[model samples]
Target: MTEQNVRRRGGGKRKRQRGRGEQAMVPDAEFTSYYGRPVVKASPWQADIPAYLFLGGLAGGSSLLAAGADLAGLPRQRRSARLVASGAIAGSLFALIHDLGRPARFHHMLRVAKVTSPMSVGTWILSAYGPFNALATGGELLGLMPDPVRRSRPGRMLGVAGRPGGIVAALIAPAVASYTAVLLTDTATPSWHAAKRELPFVFVGSAAAASGGMGLVAGPLDESGPARNMAVGGAVLELGASRIMQHSMGIAAEPLRQGTAGTLHTAATALTATGALGAVAVRRSRIASALSGLALTAGSACTRFAMFHAGQASAHDPRYTVVPQRERRDRESSPT
Candidate 1:
């Protein structure tokens, strides 16, 4: 009787253990932040920062074009490009200062040189580029003025310094155009950090497109060939890099394809494509060239704003930060 009871009890205990194991299945935990707060804070940057990004790229590209036009002996195009560069740089500085809330903040940024800090590098780049751009523009303006003013000592000095200044600025133009991409990617924002490899190409291409558009709008039709080429090449680079980045970024790319960012990016892609085509297809028509330039300019601006908003969106959403990290960990842990 005792042996039978002991066997029955053992079988019942084993059955209960199996049942408990089957019923204990837990649902996967949804990715959620502590107290429903965002895992990462969205950057405090305002619209001014995006404006600065666009204007900075525009200025950098224009400086490069101006240097090229100078060497090509296209005086009209050079003049127009220098003017655009100067104006764009000034606007960029204003936007940056405005966002910083004080001119002193910008001055403070210049107090140190840190290779590891994108912002520091960018500030120095701007400093080096700005004076040269100003000198070039001053010379261009002096040339446009009356002979009396152009012959003055100060005017002559600026005019003499202009070409060399433009060449120097051109050397630094690539950094100016692309450093913002590095700055954004260095941040903890999921989308920006994820697309680090492609974002710089996108920024550089956008800069070129914007500069080419300016050339088309303001330069003589006879001298617009270089501008047309830049517009086309830039359009290709921006569109291609953007597509690759979004495709490779996994969940981080969702912000780029949805909501306000998506809408802006769509408009940017369409406008850039249309403008590039127009720059080539209607190269002989002044009216068409101007229209194409306008489209490219608008498109470049949209791209910057799109990226900024996309980063903010990704930072605000917990999943964009958490899921990619978990996936990466799982991949690293998995057997080869």
Candidate 2:
């Protein structure tokens, strides 16, 4: 055979070479095995997963904000932060339970602690955080747990135990916001895997901003100064991160710009921007605070749906998988 024929046959002369012969004989359609069984089924993850993720982040962020306010000598801010934090935590737990295919089986997740598994770590974090958050709120509600109890041996023990847990929750708050991104990244989902880095940052920022918005709405204006600042900062970060995500993802980011995902993303962006700006103007006004809070909550919810739909969109398109893999292989084979 001529040299041209050999090169056309994937640069091989052997007639019985399975690798080269397979590529040569099979059409692109046949080579792809697109007609075979699908690589992934529809995600078993329910809507509650997104809801719980958002709420858990809000709780954690609010707790941190409250702690900061308490340190700053803002009594009303501390109270509002504690109250909202507790509510968010409770709502998160409820959503988590509701999402489980077998709600009773959730205990199995805590049967063994595995650091390598995000789910396992998350379960432990929740287990440790839930009660402490509840107690903190309880203490605030019961008028600071009484001077005697605050200083007693049992009180000290409770304080010791609760303090560490609170700190852990605060530290984990950002992770809680971002880990859902990791979950989506590890999957076969196209949009998620493609924009892995940006997704996490966007979620984290949104959570923090949402939490700040809640604090602003619930607390007195003078006490809510920090929350307003935090909300503004978070909104700026989220907007920048999302823009980077869209630009970096190329065609895979199409879902984020179109269809249901597109609509939600646009709404989220608008609400987040509006609320952040409102925070500055309403730092002292209850009415402004209320509107900002509403916007932030709506924005956070829209973000979650946009993310979920983006993943679904990515998974539905075969080109997302095929084109990237082919390009990678081609690049690897080319000489420097």
Candidate 3:
């Protein structure tokens, strides 16, 4: 055939193939790991960890309130706060040791102080804070004894020392309330790590809510001013921080919005809001104060549990791991 005739023949063959719908096969890809396995292992943690977190925060925040009440000369409120601080710290220590499977494991952690390690620093914080809180509470209890015992030289010395001890504990309280957030965010878990910037705020705010709630429950209306203020401020901070974290985390926050985690978070928000409103609206009613305090404390517990479960959910799901990394890479490669 001639050259032009041959070219026409090739074009006709291509047209025929196109008409037959021949095309490349591009199988749709899914966000998954090899063999559909999880991208990361779920932490070997239980509900005890969340309990420990909540108790530790409660202890820390209560220590701060106790110091403030002492300085303000609100003896009744100071006593209540100191008692709560000591009890919560004890419970926190117990929960942590239970999670570690042995008491010795917790003590072993204090052998060395590592600046880069959140767990190590948290252990030291607890060690220092716990004793001071206990001493302060002891002094408060001593003062409650009959006049004869309270007037004893040893009792007077202890009471004198407790103010300084509690002041030292208050100094370390912020770290106690926030270090758990640092520890969680430092992990490879997608939801927890993505919330690095706001988690500490959420935690500290929850701590304040818990302690303030306790104060409202135990303190009289005349001395509940600080507690009311703390509860309201803490409620605002916790709710705002949670919203910011969810908005900023993108896909990583999905775990927090779905399943059991979502339900808990919703409950926490409602309870905290209601408690804050009740605190402001019914300051004269002891019944209202007790109810509000209970709500706030419950809300704080729910928040901790929600965060714990969300981190586990994100770690178990490959999509939460893969999608964010891919998006990050795309953003890096895109033109500015």
What does candidate 3's lDDT look like per residue over 92-164, in tens digits?
Answer: 8898998999889998998899989999999998888888877788788888789888889988888888888
lDDT tens per residue, model 1, 137-239: 8888888799989898888898899889999999999999999999999999999999999999999999999999989999999999888888788988999
Evaluate all candidate structures by whole-model CA lDDT and list the values in order: 0.91, 0.76, 0.89
Clash count per candidate:
0, 0, 0
Best by lDDT: 1
TM-scores, each model vs. reference: 0.93, 0.82, 0.92
In candidate 2, what are the lDDT values of residues 1-336, reduced to their tens digit?
Answer: 665776555444334565655334333442233365444454777788778878877887788887777678887887788788888888888888888767676788889998877777778787877776766675565556788877888677665555454555566556656676677776777787888878888887888788888887788876777888778887888889989989988778888878998999999999999998898775667888878977886788788888888778767666666666777799999998
In candidate 1, which residue ranges exceed 4 Å CA deviation? 1-23
Model 3: how far residue 297 lies from native, Å: 0.9
Q: Could you tell me which 10 consecutive residues in candidate 3 have the lowest summed lDDT?
A: 7-16
Candidate structures ordered by TM-score, highest first = 1, 3, 2
User: What does candidate 2 score on TM?
Assistant: 0.82
